[model samples]
Target: MPDNSRYSAHIGYLFNELPLESRIAAARAAGFSAIEHPAPYAVPAADMAALLREAGLPYVQFGLRSGDASRGEKGIAIFPDRRDEFRANLAEGLDYAEAVGVRMLHAMAGVLPAAEWRPEHRACYLENLGLAAEEAGKRGIRIIVEAMSPGAVPDYFLPTAASAREAIAEAGHANLGLLLDVFHTVAAGDDPVQAIHDSGETIAHVHIADHPGRHEPGSGRIDFAAVRSALDAIGYAGFIGCEYVPAGVTADGLGWLPRRA
Candidate 1:
């Protein structure tokens, strides 16, 4: 079994009952070793860092802004025209991460019309990733890219672990790695176990959510035990992020959490 200590609560998904500033304490109370957030821009970096310090928890990972959500832009990395925007977002994320003690940053590859996904888009993504990795590396930070499930985000640039792996290889940066989310791997019709094995050391971080509904573990068909076994097999010592929606109350659904000794 995976170590209970190797779990972090994604406050952006869990602990929705409380305000953002309060979720850090809630996660600590729930026994999570650490905490991560998808979007922490709303909270000033110094304030967020103070909360983590007060809660005695490390801020593990966080996502860069996915462009203008109001405009339905899931990401900006894949657009040659938005390279400036992508870099600006990365700089902002890096500043926040440095302040909050986060060592891993997730960079989302934005969507594009199916027919418009040209070689230039791929080239642009590689270039942007290389730049991100190099810049983040200077701070001893790692850059991660996740493959979103098509069912959840249509036209998402990287739609499978294989694709994200390919991009990582193409980027060829030691500081760049894959952010493997089991929900996306399974929902994309790929074996999560196989993905874990394939990603191995290239996986800088992980996210967990049940398939079919993206709900908390045990609410869907995913074999979380098997998932744990695979993670162990790969020697993934990093925290596994609880990035799922609660079927009911977030704390109530935490029965799935392995008991900590």
Candidate 2:
């Protein structure tokens, strides 16, 4: 049965082969009230909203695309040169968030340029983050910067919860929070529970995938029970995203979790 009143599982791009409406409907069929993954921008907001409402699902939070801005490539937020472009993309992303009535924004700060390892690169990232904070604050959107594993996202400015925490701290803003993913946490060598505890006030959106291969919870080595306890202890109340690569059908792989209805 499906638990009508419980935690929502965030489906990812792994299930994109299905039409967006079907995907949202299937998530509802499987008993989750929300969805996540790459920004669902291709589908018009009104249309997306209609499907979600019909299925009784909430359009909780989604990603910010990171690609080329110059020559059509458009990311690497916080770099000195990309600041203006990044802000434009941020504003654009915020507009999508508003359309869905989302309270939090899941952001990929793009990769830091190769020079970010240099002395001057540090200042550039901090200054740019300040602007991002200001912009997100204006829209009442909580922007969480994600940190991926080195193997996953090599040059990105935020590559671990620790680094994300430090950078957000340095930027010194309340709206800026950490978008922690368990798979990346394991890849980045972080204690998943401790990372959330460490982030304290800044841990916003969470993406949950088990490790070894980004499979659905319980399909990989992560102890979801422990992780769930950690979130419960912290009084965290946000979508625990299932941003995993499907081993089979996405729902079949994740249906192991307990459901109420």
User: How much does candidate 1 score in TM-score?
Assistant: 0.97
Backbone collision count in every prediction?
0, 9
In model 1, the runs with Cα more than 4 Å from the true position are none
C-alpha lDDT of all candidate models, in order: 0.90, 0.71
What value does the lDDT take at residue 204 in candidate 1? Answer: 87
TM-score on alpha carbons, each prediction: 0.97, 0.88
- Candidate 2 per-residue lDDT, tens place, 50-148, comes to 877788877767756566545432245655676666677778778887887776766556555566366556677677677767887898877777787
The CA lDDT at 106 in model 2 is 60
Which regions of candidate 2 fall more than 4 Å away from where they truly are?
Answer: 1-6, 69-75, 112-116
Cα miss at 195, model 2 (Å)?
1.5
lDDT of 1: 0.90
